[model samples]
Target: MRKLLGACSLDVFARVDPLELIAPAPQGAALALYVNLLAESLHAAGRTARAQANGNSYGETVGELALGLAFELGARQGDWDAFCTALAAEHARAPAFWRQAGGEALLRKKVNDMFAVLRDKVDADNYQVACGRPCSPNRLYAYRMLDTAYGEIARLFAGWREHTAQVGAILGRPVDFSVPIEVRQLQSVAACRPEWIMRWSESLERFGGAPGPLHTKSKRFESLKNSPDKIADMLREIAEYEAISSNRDSGWLHDQDTAGAWIEDYWRVLDESAHGATPGPDLILEARTEELDAPMVEVAQAAPVADDDPLDAVRAQAVSLPPGFLSAARATQDPGSWAGRMLEDDSLPVRLAVYLKLLGAEDDCYPDAWRDPSTGALPNMQQLAALDAVSLPTLRKRRDAAIARLEAAPRTGG
Candidate 1:
């Protein structure tokens, strides 16, 4: 793991103000700095990984970091073309800065600042989406600070003999000639006591002549200053994720094959199915319909059927649907709408299913009747597939085809 700081220097702690860090950058240059810094970091990490005789841990770390930042960037909803144009503008403004001495570190810091803010924004949005709760960016920064504090404390604990006074202050005890049992027993951040964290924050002023994050006179962590329980919860969350990530990294399946091995499996399955080793190209199974209670809708076929046709009854028996599905579909239909007219040949349920796939399960435009009663959202792909009496893959193919048609369709009016 890379240390946040080279040594335990609390005084030199970087402030977590994204606005201030980005204030110096030109209006359109932030994204450019982020991209260049990421490329540079990845290149450096690659070289370091190659130079190391033991393992590629450095490269792995950098790759994971880049992946995370990329995810945040992707989650953002904006004009990407504007961002690209802004990046070009920034380069034009700083042609000399790109080749100047010490410019690399400055640019890297700017990139870090951009990501720091972006991470909090992305996480805040995710938290809202997942939990239906509000999470401020400052709160996320506090969580980061707490995690950093735990890491620093862990580092200090590992070398207690050299930093006896600091460690003793953190433990709220005097240093003696004998080794402290707390230092010996502390194996991970999970084992670190809540009281130890409070004490560490309190003791920072005595040693470093500066207040710690929690003890600082700032409103950023004000809510966390007095709540050790909250701090403990945050620390535990960090430890839990660390443990989970570490376990996943060392899993046996990771060594089974290269990342592209799944492509081979995909092709093999397709080949087998094509050769008639599997039941059908559609992979539909009648047994899967047993779980549903209502008859399925045949959306793929648009041929008109007689009201009392015997074939209709036989087709209805092939698949099942949830109770009241047909009524809900009927209630939500709008024949004059663009979607309704375009998909007029398909049943209302199938039209809703396509809309559900295109626009997510929950959308402002979706009628309450279209939502699954159990979830208060649109039915999932499996449920939609079951409604149509087709396999999941078949539903996906149909949905994608519908999307393609919509994209190709010409617009009439503004």
Candidate 2:
């Protein structure tokens, strides 16, 4: 809702570069459009001025980051020279390109595309950053589509009384729109079955003189027709995400220091990816694997009574410690609880490997927990591998394997 620039000169943004500024990742066209939308808002100041001129009218100001993103996109998609030329030519109207035939249409399409992608990317990142889990761009798209389906179902439910016959056709029975809808009744995505969605779409033609969303040939929602379980999973994910998102401090995107810190995180993730770090397993595949391996759980538990369970003390220590990174250095006083926990995990090599993965080879926060008490600095992989008496490959393998198990374990609820 924050307007990026009220009335700034175009020269101020001449140096913007859209692609380079974006969070480093394999983003798609949607994200590009989102960045460009911010740029478009800058050029269309007359509209904002007019809205403000008309007293008591509501208006939305694009955020500054969004504006910078737009400039980057506009510089790429729209001709900066032509736009600047047109702006210089006349102080009154929109640029020549905007007034030219088909120019507005082209710009509009580009703008729409940018915003469409941006929204999903933001939502996806919101889920990942908060959850410390991974979510792909495709998953973001799925969440949006499922959210759309949920919305359509809610609309039909709200108007069920007035269109009882049409609704009855879809519901297979029912005369109860008069009664207030309860959240419990609409808890599961299965309640809004894919067949119901298809039926609702068919019923809409007679009741509202138009086919429903899925009834169309778009194929966007076509994938939802037969995947009720997938739909249910997404429904729950989005619901949980909604709660997490609501509680998050969106102010980070606005504050300079906080936003810079976020960008650092973004860069760190990209750096890790470049270095071949894994972002955990694919959810569906992992779930399937867990199911198949469920039978071995009891056997493993029963056979684990060895006198020397390698790293049992270490594992217990690591499990009991609090959150935060641990350095190699032992505190002169009491080393931090996190450090103690990591030591207790028993396998020093695995624990050190985890430190490398999480805190990176070096972090500012590592000052207190370095391997050498003299130098409060984290050691590199080569150092950890050397300490563990194994080759780099073996250390990495053990580290990743341990982290995978830790990630898969049930938490008290992160």
Candidate 3:
């Protein structure tokens, strides 16, 4: 009883530390919490501007790092929807912060911070591969996981429905009931409903499904499956897919020329990684070719430059020039306005990456920067909650502004 009291006291003590609220004791989710803990590290590095000028990309890169780690971890472990919603919320915010600092500062910060998360995430991915899950562990998200779990429950219900026929046939009685409650009334099956699984997961005390151990009186639903492995696999699957769903690397980025000047080595490095294997035989190559051949829509430009198309100029600027406000501005055919030049650039992804680079990946990257002295701390959930304090939806406003500015630019501005 003395030992039990001590352990309970220890848990309570751990909870009182605000830092532990994010990380938990002994690191249940170190990589995850560290993604946030980074602000503390960067705060240690000095002011955001100073840290950014060196290309720390601390905030943006940390998001990416967390994504890769979360993807792998979620794929291996637990409930996914809550995990992914948390990530989607994180990623959607950083690029705008990076963009405002200008590209040079953004690059410096990213270069500064990527080492730790990459190592751990890659390790997680390697483990996932070795484990031989039918899909990589890092591939699912919260909603999809819930969907899968729901499907499994439905199937189990169907099987139970079928099983009743066998039971009735043996017992010389009619079998009827959706979740086997009748059996529970006469026996000890408890008639646990699968719906309860999701209900339990959504509760706040459970951390959106990161509940304590399943084999407990409060979590009596575990009896429904009878096999511990079944629940373990389902829970682990939630974690895996959540990890994968948050990764930013999907899409046609493997395509050459689709990427801006900085990525000219796409083909070369891909070949090198494959030990000089011919590119023609690659499926990735074929898919890229197909995508590139699809109709290309030309985004209108803002101003005149020596090159009729400022897209090439932007490419040159990215490859040969250092990233900064003027470098990106000079790349544009037009130098008139900030976002206008981005729309004027021919490569859409580069234009977007540049925005993401500058803005720090969130829609509200430029929100009321004037408010407060600026901690440059990545906004906590509390700070972000304050973002809704602004009357207009940020994405709607930015999109309106970008399109308005792009359309208003003179054709010759290109």
Question: So what's the TM-score on candidate 1?
Answer: 0.44
lDDT of each: 0.51, 0.44, 0.33
Best by lDDT: 1
After superposition, which runs of candidate 2 have C-alpha atoms over 4 Å from their true positions? 1-99, 131-134, 174-184, 187-198, 208-210, 249-414
* TM-score, prediction 2: 0.39
Least well predicted 10-residue stretch by lDDT in candidate 3: 384-393
Which regions of candidate 3 fall more than 4 Å away from where they truly are?
1-249, 252-333, 336-414
Per-residue C-alpha lDDT of model 1 across residues 245-326, encoded as one tens digit per residue = 3443234543334322332233334334544656443443332323211112212322223324232222222222234455
- lDDT by residue for model 3 over 307-341, one digit each (tens)? 34332233223222211322323343233333433
**Which ten residues in a row are the worst by lDDT in model 2?**
293-302
Q: After superposition, how far is residue 370 of candidate 2 from its true place, in Å?
A: 32
TM-score per candidate, chains pooled? 0.44, 0.39, 0.21
